[model samples]
Target: MASLPQALPEPRAAGPAERPAPPPVARVRRRRRPSGEPPPLPRQLRASGRWWLGLSALVLLACVAVVATGTIRYVDVADTRVLQAIAEIRSPALTAVAEVLGLLASDPVLHAIWLVDLVLLAVFRRWRHLMVWLGVGLLVINVGAAMATTLQRPRPFEVEVLGEWSGFAMPSLPVTVLAALLVSTLYSLVPPGRKRTVGKWVVCGLLVLTAASRLYLAQDHPTGVLAGVVLGVATPLAAFRLLTPNSVHPVRYTRARPAHLDVSGDRGAAIVRALRDQLGLVVTDVSPFGLAGSGGSTPLKITVKADDTVRADESCVFGKLYAATHVRSDRWYKLGRTLLYGRLEDEKPFQSVRRLVQYEDYILRLFSDGGLRVPQPLGIVEITPEREYLLVTEFIAGAREAGEAEIDDAVIDQGLGIVRRMWEIGMAHRDIKPANLLVRDGTLYLIDSAFAEVRPSPWRQAVDLANMMLVLALRTDAERVYRRARLHFSDEEIAEAFAATRGLTMPSQLRRMLRQQGRDLQDQFLALLPFRLPPVRIQRWTWRRAGLTVVALAAAAIAAYVSAGVLAAPL
Candidate 1:
């Protein structure tokens, strides 16, 4: 009567395969020009980023309304008769190399290389590239020196004026403050793709060679070097829409991630075509498991095979590839620790990536249909679009970690029948710790039930029995794991699972179990688990959070009238 191993299906990633290839060798040795309609430059460069931030904020409010309008005095006497006919057709070999390229792009040698790049971005603390060069060099050098001292406008050629400068030009603060500090220091020291497009055309060719050496040394006139390179490219595009990062994160306060490396090469062959197009598992090979952590989603590890349609005892499996394109800054790190504590994680409540690979393939087919032990998932892949996914399972062949085995009593009676069949089918794993428990051959599998759940939670089943009884009392102890967790919890449900670690939600797996079980196992788990804090009413909703209690009683009545106007301001 043998008939079970089926469970694969899931699907959904569907994008790259409506079959379209064979076009390149210069589009078939260049001939068919009679329009076939395939390449509208990738649909007119899929524009979005707020249409290039509203076309660089309408060309920086039309170059700060043409340098405070005298609208370049209708081409100021035709740009002072084309800079006195190019400063009388200069030729002492091009006016001594335009007076040494206007004293090597001067303004005190680019303000001593912008004060040694703001003292090495304050000795490398980078505060967002020193707040985009102190908010785009204090609004492009004090609004182009108060719009060149209230449009005083004067300079052009009192003699063969070759170098030295003065002021009152209306705009030319070194071609709008060195093209907005060399395009925000080549967009904060060249980063985004192709070395920030060759550092934006080498800061627009050294801001057009310092605006053609301030108009070949005739100095301020070509409408003040075209209104100081249009207020230095609109003050670093309005300091990138006012210091962007409202949310980026991908977790980078460093450390952790070293479980060997390669952190996914060739995105592990696009996660073996997302396990043969979303979990059918046709992959042949790909490996490297565990240690992905540091965020910006890069979990990988494979060892597939599957092929000959499944059964060689459901062919070799072992894979983990989450790839949410390497989840940066802890993708809203567990919804900001469940919006600052309370109602913790249970996977999907949506934070997309196909709702975390459809909530870890519905928590490994709800722990392989209730009989507990896990892994088995074997499929679900979306290798990109709403940013990547992959979740093949079945990798248990002789497992290991519950902190490298040996807590004894047959791994404490198969982690007490996987925590009493997850509290008799009213589930809740809420990450049980000891690297998601394993111990293979001698049973107890439960590997990452991607924050398992089912409902009727008693403080998430007392955080999966006080994180598997303080991860088996750190590999043995606390009275032999509280005498095998009092044969399934008693002393007041182990003091409400050690008083639900005083309202946990300090997430990263309860801050790595209070930095490896400290606070002397919280008074030896508050003298053997099970707590009591029943109290009563605190319903201050006032019609469902009346505008957050009138903005917290108008910020505590303006902080008690500014602390009684600083104690009636007399001192």
Candidate 2:
């Protein structure tokens, strides 16, 4: 073979050719200012100069206009006639509109709105907004009363009537209330983006409708009604703007404490003495039960005194006692089912006493019927005009119990079993947590069924189970807990339940504990496992005789090879 031609000698490295350096980066030149030049004024200050002067001038003009209008009072009979004509032209449409507006203006509607606002604010913990709304409502009512007295304007003497009236004619109270309500409503419904255009039109429409109703019903002269409407709208708006955030008054209730009074003296004796004096329940002795607990909403419990009963029917004594001056804070638990507290001691006949008593009694009976343990409700009593009401129930005697160091596995199993039973009965305990489950005499008792409802859904059940698991996992091994859960539940079923609970699981508690202890062990183990497996199928086959012959030849060759190997090894 001919030798391959010698590979061409590698080219020698080229000598460094001189490279031109990059052109020097161009320097940014700085412009020089005149030596004696003064600094420019800020844009905001320049803009403000003309704005402030214009605002002052406009306000001065408004003041002048208001004074001029107040002094120059000419009854515009011609304008009144024009309004009447317009009203007649749109009488049918106006009547229909009035009916809808009238519903809003009604006392019941306003009261309902007030109650709803109160409940919402309370639920959201917006104490400040609650006070603001309450103050605004009260101020409106007061202003209406003041204007009715001050104006002393008479009802219209010439127009046909359409509605009933009882209040003073001038600056009509109803019309004033309607105006204030319309202003407040418009303020609420109109947002800041559309404040100028949309809000103005809505408010104008309300004013027109209100004025028409007043004129049609002959409740007041056009001048008086118009004046009332203006004042009602203007005063509240001004107050809202001028009143500092802290000016509004808030309602609060008092809680009695031991430090506020001498418990050994007659003064303190008077607090619990009412049990035997008024309610006919006897007190054997008084003992301090530590600090009273309240839910921060409605009825504040303070310095509860345990009393012994004279008769077997009298299980305990309860009463509304005066507050001791030492306690500075307000504490109340707004009971969801009923309003059981908040009243003066001197008032006669409790308000809504029957409803309160009925609910208390009904709750006790339901718990008993449902095989759920609960404190026995003895009776409910309300003292006269002072709306103070009391519900006496059998108290579960015990210390403030500590949660068990470890949740019994059996208890967890039983609790879930109970939840399943509850579903079978078409019911659900909406609020299920460790705090509501009582461990008395080694038995589990579910308490606080106030949020219970009739419908039990998979989502609800899952949440309930997840919450229970979370409570147990706080004091037990998560893997063990999961294994126990899997014993009774299929993996897929557990996964579905876990999904419904939004991924809340016992492993979260483990992670939290590890973090607290400064440990870094990664959570690599899986908690939820799938339950169902894919199906398997078997196939049937038909074979010809040729396939059998091939199988027989392969078997004979394997046997012959094995026999030859054995003989060769022996020889």
The candidate that wins on TM-score is 2
Summarize candidate 2's per-residue lDDT along 1-571 as a digit string, tens digits.
2222232222111111233222221112223334563211101223333443355345335434644676313344543564466456556666666666555455656555555555655664544344445556566567666655554444444455555565565455665566665555443333333553587677778678767665654555665565566555664454333331111111212344222222333323432344343334444544433222211112212223233423332233222222211111121122211122112101122124344444446655555555544454445433221222344444444422113433666655555544544555556565565545555554455544434555655556655655555444545555655666655555654455555443222224333444564522222112334342232111122232245446667866974564344223210
Total clashes in model 2, counting residue pairs 3 or more apart in sequence or in different chains: 10
Off by over 4 Å in 1: 1-134, 137-143, 150-174, 185-189, 192-201, 204-206, 213-291, 295-466, 469-488, 494-571
Across 449-544, the per-residue lDDT of candidate 1 in tens digits comes to: 665677745866876776776676676766677666666556666666666554352236545655765646545766654445342122323432
lDDT of 2 at 562: 46
Top lDDT prediction, candidate number = 1
As a whole number from 0 to 100, the lDDT of residue 176 in candidate 2 is: 59
| Whole-model lDDT, model 1 | 0.58
**What are the Cα lDDT values of the candidates?**
0.58, 0.43
